[model samples]
Target: MDFDKLRESCRKISMPPEMKSRIKTNCKAANADEKQRSRTDGRLVAVCVCCILLLLGIGLTYSGIFERKLPAASDRADASKAENENKFAEILSTAKLTADRIFETTRANIDETEMSSKTQTQSQQSTESTVPEQTTEFVTNPFVFPNGEHAANTGSDDLSYVRPLYLEMSNRENLIIAKEAAETMSQEDFDLFLAENQSMLQGGYFHSMNAGEYLEFTQREWYIPVAPEDMAEICWMYYEPTHEKIDLGMDFSETSKIRFDINETYKADYYYKDSNKYRYEKTIQRDNATIKIYSRRWLYRFENFAWKGYRMDITVCGQEMSAITTEMPLEELEKYLEMIDFVTIKDWLS
Candidate 1:
């Protein structure tokens, strides 16, 4: 692009050796003829050189015009980026404003909930000894499968957290029939029912095992059948305190998680010191409906008292519902199974 350098390069240009030799031979022959012809020959030579210079200048100009006409790749990319921004800027701004509003609303609700919880706790502390509510989310291997739900209050601390899945029905009629059938059994009949089924407590209550170092899911929270309203709650998963390793979301990929999600066969391996009681699998008939159970029982001790605990996963046939019960009255669960008999009284349930 420097004009001075370009002009210098052009000045250095010379005719080819062969062409200069031929031109020199013609000029010598013309000089021998006459001065007029010699001057004419000189002018002819000048015209040839001028034409060569003109052609060279024309070629350089053609190339320079093309080079200036075409845009660069980076220039094209920047133009495309600007066009996209112009098209979506308003839409993006609107979306950001909506997202900020939603976030603020969620934060406000969480703060309000915390305030309510604090007030309730203070009132409880004023009355009697209180087991502080733990809001921390915990997960572990095998039996303590996460329901993928965070409940603000799992349930009453001193009682079982297993709620009948039938109560989860949206229809008012479904709620009434399920609750009534569950409550219909009188205290005597319920005790009789427990005796009939193996619902009686296997171990003592309030007894702490030697394994106090382990965390038990039943002590704080419990698991129940997780399914849609159309499906029955059959399988329950809960953790019992044992001397075994507690895998709290550690080495997840290496650990083969126990999954008995809805509709999957409930066959899984567990361990225990006792070979016989390591696992129990059976199919029993209740209310003329077949029920499959996968269970393991263990005994824990504190001082002289012995507490019996079981990690039982019961699947009610045909209804697709399951439950896991421990340290609580199993009769309450039995009443549930008998109440929601889908095989014989399908119409009644429907």
Candidate 2:
């Protein structure tokens, strides 16, 4: 058959309504398939969109740009890190505070210990000082009595009780009269001679020829206030004239130029083997604001039996302070006297 005739024959063979219905059914099925395909394409697009959003969220979480619900282990690790950091900071702070406190306490303790040691040392020293030393013996000078009275000399060998001598020097005044009076007396006659002539010498005159006379006469004589007349007599009795006059002496020419600051002067009564009364001198000094007082006594001896002394005191409240004493031969004593303008005269009236 020809191709057109073959197609006509096939169209004639089909059943009419049933075949049409089946055809419609088939067309419907095709349309449904097409709609299904479009819906499937839309669903595929939605699924892709959901996948992209999920991927973006995952990326953000990985980069720490979004909060995430952490697994238990991750949460524990983060918490542990914070705890360790806090612990480290707490330890450092506690250590710093403790070190500061320890340092301060240690410093305070050292200071307290040093102070305690010093105080203990001072107390120990004070305790040691309270006891008197057995080796030290204080022998008070008998002449330097607390009551201001001097002890009398009994001619005993103990001369420690003998008083010291005090003198002041200045320009000459009425010393000529004293010089004349002192020259006239002999060792035996000194007491009477001094008794009569002591009035001629007004300033602190004592008749004696002991070592002190040579000491004083040869050195110098200065004007001092007169003591009691009995004191003068006692001194004259104790001092006797020598067999030969030692010409070595100095003049008391400076008596008027010198000044005096008298602190204290005293006399002590004494007795001898022959019952002749005698006396000794004592002087004392006191301290003032700007000056110190000094005390001394005139001591002279004609013989072992005859001895005499007079008290003298000087103060330097506004002046200088110096003391000197020495022993020399009779020749030197005479020369010292002559140098000081003390001239020996024979005639009492002249």
Candidate 3:
């Protein structure tokens, strides 16, 4: 026999149908066991994986590694964290507010600077465009007096001039003493004396009072009272026009004028009526730029209770001496003249 064939046949004979079925069952059982073992092994691997995941979860929760971040506690770290956040927000807000304020302030400063620059530029331009104002001069007309002795062009609408009346240095006591020594007269006689010197008393041209004259103080018809009341019991007066009016200029605003400076001295002088009476001599010096004129006034009191008025005599004594007479009512001017300052005349001239 062939040993290999024999062995194969023997193996077949030993494997009976029932026995084969049993063997098959045993093999199936063994396969079931293997399957069961594989399932068990898979379950153990799943369990180990689950256990590792659970431990990792536990560790993460305890250590706060993979856990949800906790909120700050109301009484602990959460409150502190919230306060810090609020402070940080406040700081940020303050910073932003500060930045905004700085921006606004800078913008306002720029605007103000621009406005000031514009205003200054406009002012400068206006000043440059404007012109300075010029002063105007006025010229007057020429007028001649009927007397033909004087003429003037005052450089205005009319002839305007001022003349000194009288100057004296005697005191009231001296005046009283002089009044006692002079001649006596009545009020009626004094009135006639004033009427005779009407031209001088009214400060007018000799021609007007003489016969027919056009020159006057206001160039209008104004009259001086013939009889003016007196102030003192007796008083002396002196008045004179130093020189005849001369042609000044058509524009005499800047012109140097003839001014009279009178020096009055109180001394014992012989009067025409009574030599023992006190008399005042006023020496007046008049000057323009080219020449000087001299005039004199001598005053004497006429002692009369009834005729206590002021009597004035004026005369220019270079070539010849002529007496000019005028009178004033000292009584009417007494109140005003008492409070007047003599130096005020110099201030007015200045």
Candidate 4:
């Protein structure tokens, strides 16, 4: 049949209304029944899964698969002990800090007390020091000092403690007097003597080790290098009152122009402004002895007078000696030092 004819034939083919309704009702009821059956099956599967999981969990529990080993009693005790020790250490640390603080406080108090005591002692000492000590008079050189008091001769060192006591007792005006007194010498005679007898003279100050002129105070007046009672260079001062040359080191002094102690062991230096005015220092080995040479370009004070020059120091025969003079040339000074009888003096010392 043709498509148009076939389509007309299909349109004529209609179902009964009751039969179509019955078919639709049957389809809806079947869909509802299928949905109900699906819901019941899902509920049954869920219940079966829950029962299987519960049984599996119980079986695992009975087989001991999830069991853990219990810690030993000793381990538990150790843990408890460690905790107690930690707490005890913490308490001890706190106590230590408290003790440290107490110690520091006590130490500070002790320091304050010591400081107070020291201050009181110092104050008392200062007050006592302000008061003058009693001074005795000089019997021999009474007229020399203003207060008729002179320093006691402590040793063989020249002017040991003399200049300081003079300075202490004397005023500035007396410094000028000191300068004048120091310079009261026959310069012409000194020059002539240095020129002539310098090489001949030895043994510090004595001319020939001959003891002369028995003076009071167990001192013999021997050959003096320079003259006129007030002047001194190398001097032989002390001797037995018997005019006996019993020992070589009766008393000897070596004075020079520049300021330095012989060995600088004694405070005999005429004070100078500074050591900063130094020129140079030198060392020389001569006659089995070390000679130290110190030269300064600045002035040195002899009482109030200022002088400057070269200084040479040497220790020989257990005696400190030096020569510092512009009065004589270096060559002459060296010769003068060389001529000193240190070898014989060493024997005397022995």
Q: How well does each candidate superpose onto the true structure, as a TM-score? A: 0.21, 0.16, 0.20, 0.19
Residue range 96-156, candidate 4, lDDT tens digits: 5533543354355445544554454456567764322211111111112223332112212
* Backbone clashes, each candidate: 8, 36, 2, 0
True-structure RMSD, every candidate = 28.8, 44.8, 47.0, 36.8
**lDDT of candidate 4 at residue 86, scale 0 to 100:** 53
Q: Runs in model 3 with CA error above 4 Å?
A: 1-28, 51-59, 62-72, 75-115, 120-350
Tens-digit per-residue lDDT, 51-144, candidate 3: 9999998887889687565665455555644544554354345445543543354355445544554454456557774321211111111112
Give a tens-digit lDDT track for model 1, residues 273-326: 343642445555665456553331321111111112222333344553322223
The 10 consecutive residues of candidate 2 with the worst lDDT sum are: 341-350
lDDT of 2 by residue, 201-260 (tens): 322233232223431332112222222222223322112233332111111112111111
- Positional deviation of 27 in candidate 4, in angstroms? 2.8
Ranking by TM-score: 1, 3, 4, 2
- After superposition, the stretches of candidate 4 with alpha carbons farther than 4 Å from their true spots are 68-350
User: Per-residue error at 207 for model 4, in Å?
Assistant: 99
Local distance difference test, candidate 1 = 0.34
Scanning candidate 4 in windows of ten residues, the lowest lDDT window is 134-143
Best by TM-score: 1
Candidate number that wins on TM-score, 1 or 4: 1
Off by over 4 Å in 2: 1-20, 31-39, 54-105, 113-350
lDDT of 3 at 253: 23
